[model samples]
Target: MRILVIGGSFGGLTVAFSLRQKLGARHEIVLVSKEARFTFIPSLPWVAMGWRRMADISFDLAPVLSRWKVGFVEAAVIRIDPAKKQVHTAVETLDYDYLVIATGHRSANEAVPGLGPFDGPGHSLMSPPEAEEAREAWTAFLDSPGPMVIGCAPGASCIGPAYEFAFEVHHALARRGLRHKVPIVFVTPEPHLGHFGVGGFGKARQFLEGEFEARDIRYRTSAAIASISAEAVQLVDGPSLPSRYSMILPALSGVRAVAESGLGNPKGFIPVDAHYRHKDHPAIYAVGVAVALPPVEETPVPVNFPKTSNMTRQMAAVAAHNLAADILGGAPVTRTLSAECILDMGDRGAHMFADPIRPPRNRSEMSIGRRWLWAKRAYERYCLWRLKRGWAGPASGLLG
Candidate 1:
């Protein structure tokens, strides 16, 4: 059997390594990624804040995948033909018996004009390059302190990072004794604080509100950002705010290749069944933000459902297991979507665990303390070590 994975990020790497482990010496596996290095995305905020260097969070993919006996292709996937079972990259075209679409998301900066690192006034922490750019921008901001805006654009699912960046910026500025001079504002489309695109978790709204209040980080919920300029951000319903520095998390959209393949939805996300198999293409599967997921519930302002790293890992495991079952004789496994996250507030953090993602769950736990900050740092080290060892077991306790 020939299996092709179309990405090399958290979801793609997990699928490739786990599937290779499940069908060792029995099938050919190829992992394709646009970048040569794999970055620990959750730590990008630290990179932006100058707490971490790019090298600390990224490693070469060639060495890691080669150790697992998987072929690595470092090229952008220009197109995907599900009908023909072929993937066309910038360099070559490859055909596969089974295809896993873990292409993740493309930052939809175009959705919000003037909202990006380059060609815009605001910065982002989505990628290593962007984070590095943000670091430079932040350094410049420190030379002259003023009002700052930190928030997520409409349709954005990656909400946790926005919160993390806001707090980290606060901590960094406070350390420099410039936090009071630069008033920080958090603006989100979520109906309330801590909704996180999955409705409100256990006491999350109250907890976040309290934290923001304590820090004097003003926030605007259900805010619709019309656009951003070099000096200010314009809101649809409210008055424009003068901002000397802005960090806006743009919405995530489907990759252009997948969207053009005619296999994805209008938003460019691939629709998958309960087992993570593509709805129409049985041999194709999708995990991570590349897979289409409906929101837990609708709100006044639009909010896309989140696909965290831990949840994506679970989806990848299930997809890999099912693909293995297709070749070998066994029942496929089904895993529920859950989230375990540590929202780092620099010196302190909050750990939240939700089973089944939505509310009314069997287990919904949340705690806040300085230990969680230490735990988050420890998890980062453990994750890098585990990935280096090619361990792809159940991601039950993994923090993201």
Candidate 2:
């Protein structure tokens, strides 16, 4: 049997390694990706602040996968023909008995007018290029300090980075004795701080509210941005916040290839069952951000569920187990994912843990300190080292 994985990030690599270990040398596995390198996305905020570089967080994919005896195809995927059981790529078309879609997300910068670093006055930290662009903007802003705005646009699922960026900016400015000059404002679509698109964890809302207040960082909740301009950010039914520099996380949509192939929903994300198998295509599986998950609760402004790295790891493991069962003869696998995150806050960090991503959980923990920051940094190095070596050990309880 042959399996094709269409991505090269956390989801794709974990699925490939897990399958190889389970099936041994009896089956074939191939990975197709547009990028030749795998970047540790959690470190992009540090890159934007000049605390880290791209080389420190990324590594070439071919050599790493080659060491593990997996085939690598560096090409952009054009479409997947489920009926024909083939994938068309820029380089060539390949046939497969099973397929895995983990193409990640596409930043929907066009959702708001004038919201993109390359095309407009706004900036983001989703990609390497965008992070580097943000770095350049940060350097320039330091020379001429002014009021700044940082937040997430409507429909944005990933809110941790925006918080991290806000704290990092404050810390960096304070270190340079310029914090008093820069008035920082945080805006979010969530009904309140620490909702995290998954109901607030124990004391998370209180903790965040207190932290922001103590830091003197003003914030707007349940706010919708109408548009962004060079001099200010306009809000819907609210006052315009003047901002000389801005970084806003835009909404995300599935890649065009998946949407055109009729494999994803109207928003281009795949719908999967308990085992991470596609509802329509039994032979196909999806993990990570490619899978569609509804918000835990409704908010005044729209917010989607966050598909974090820890959640992706669990989904990949479950998908691999179920795929193995289809060929190796066993019962299917089911799993309930927990929320685990180490949020970087410049010099300090916060560790948030919930038994499940949704509410009414048996366990919820939240703590903040300098030690958590050290742990976050240490985990980044350890994770990259392990991944580069292709060690597909256990996939549970990873603090991402």
Candidate 3:
């Protein structure tokens, strides 16, 4: 049997490595990705603040996959044909008995006019290159301090990074004795602070609010960014804020290749069942931001639901288990959609665990302290080490 995984990030790598362990040498497994290296995305904020370098968070994917005896293809997938069971890349077309679509998300910077690294004056930490650009921008900002605005664009799902970058920026500026000179303003589309794209997590709202207050980081909620200018950011609600430096998180959309495949939703996210199998195509599965998930509830300003790294890893595990069940004979597993995150605030951090992801959950835990900051740093190293060794690190269950 042949299984193909299209992506080399958290979800894709987890699925590929887990399946290889389960199926052993009996089946063929291939992992395809556009990039040659895998980057630890959570550390991008630190990269932006110059606390971490790209090399510190990224490693070549070919060597790791080679050690696992899995074939690696470094090419952009142009299309996927569920009916034909084929994946077409820029250079080749490969057929597979089972397919996992973990292609992740593309930054929908065009959603808001003049918002993005390429077309706008603002910076983003979504990708490794973007993080490097942000680091350069940060260094330049320190040379001439001024008012700054940081927040997520409307429909942004990955909101944690925005908060992390904001606090980290505050911490960096304060350490350099430029905090008073450069006033920091946070703006978000969420109705309130700490909504985090899934309503609000336990006491997270209060905790974040208190932290922002203590840091003197003023914020504006229900803020829809209309456009970004080199000199300032304009809101749809008739407010214009002066900001010499702006870092706005762009909304996520489906990769163009996935969208054109005719297997994705309007927003380009693949619709999947509880088992992470595609709703229309049984042999195809999806995880991470590539899968479509509705918001817990609607708000005045649109907010796409978040898909954290932990939750994505959980989805990958479930999909891998179900695929093994189909081929090796076992009970299929279902995803729990659990989330575990450690939000770094430069010197301090907040750790949150939400089972089922929505409110009124069975388990919801949150805590903040300096120890968590160190814990988060350690987790980065541990995660990279585990992934490089082709192990499926804990996503859920007791260890998670």
Best by lDDT: 2
* Per-prediction TM-score to the true structure, in the order listed: 0.97, 0.98, 0.98
**lDDT for model 1:** 0.89
Residues 299-389 of candidate 3 have per-residue lDDT tens digits of: 9888889998888898988888888889999887785677889998988999988877887798877898999999999999999999989
Model 1 TM-score is: 0.97
Give the Å error, residue 84, model 3. Answer: 1.4
**Per-residue CA lDDT of candidate 2, range 107-223, in tens?**
988899988897689999989999999999999999999999999999889999999999999999999999999999999998999988898878989999999999999999999
Any runs in candidate 2 off by more than 4 Å, and if so which? 396-400
Worst 10 residues of 1 by lDDT: 391-400
**Model 1 CA deviation exceeding 4 Å by range:** 396-400
Q: Can you rank all candidates by lDDT, best first?
A: 2, 3, 1
Ranking by TM-score: 2, 3, 1
Please give the lDDT score at residue 177 for candidate 1.
Answer: 82
Better of 1 and 3 by lDDT: 3
| Candidate 3 global CA lDDT score | 0.90
Return the lDDT, model 3, position 400: 23
